[model samples]
Target: MNREKLPVLLDNEIIEIRPDQSLLTERYTDFGINFINNLEKDQPFFFYLAHSMPHVPIFASENFKGKSKANVYGDVIEEIDFNVGRLVKTLKEKGVFNNTLIIYTSDNGPWLNFGSHAGSSGELRGGKFDVFEGGYRVPCVILGLM
Candidate 1:
């Protein structure tokens, strides 16, 4: 693996990440766990986790396999949900649950026409692009905070 191949400029700094774990589908929760586990307990902290779930590949994780009634996509969502639940549980276990702030959401509406694994924007118009309601409209869930 060549380190130079994965370089990017961020805030005037060159940043690099190994490609073996570069799947957009493989980020978020997978890396988030590491971040949370290494947190220092003496100071209050903020952790924002965004999942790339129910997104592309529509792959069902092992625990969620054959369980979702909505097919492959649904299973992926359940996996996302499960991982999030795990994070919450971990916080509670650490006695920081009440002091934590958790906000859950998607970056955009469901993608369309990228193979057969399209997602609905829940009564919105159009897909990920377009200025329609769907493009700018998506679900947002707030949890564990003010």
Candidate 2:
């Protein structure tokens, strides 16, 4: 195995921020502020904020606990939607919303067995681990940029 560039795990400072938990957004919002502040202002800032949600252990934020068209998955999705909206809202409020490029994506398929907690992993076979559409099939959405 190629271990020369193996990452130095920072288990000490890395705290578990569950997506379904409110702490996740708090953690993200804190870093989001820092991220914007760190931008040089003259150069364009490219940001990619990918957070796990509507996945497993489906836990919705306090505000969206019981609000949604879907079930737990829907509630979780709405929570994710809130975060995405917040990012855009921040950008717009800062007047840089036009120059920013935002995109959201998922890595793999959902665990069908996860029942409603799982997301639409696309129509493939197997799941999480398999050489089927259900495994590697995924899509991306691009906005604010070509």
lDDT of 2 at 23: 48
Please, what are the lDDT tens digits per residue for candidate 2 over residues 10-37?
A: 2355343222254464456557766776
Each prediction's Cα lDDT score?
Answer: 0.66, 0.66
For every model in order, what is the number of clashing pairs? 1, 2
Where model 1 places Cα greater than 4 Å from the true spot, the runs are 1-31
Best candidate, TM-score: 2
Badly placed stretches (over 4 Å) of model 2 are: 1-12, 15-22, 37-40, 122-126
- RMSD (Cα, Å) of candidate 1? 4.7
Question: Residue by residue across 81-141, what tens digits does model 1's lDDT show?
Answer: 7778877877777777888778787777778766446677666778787788887687788
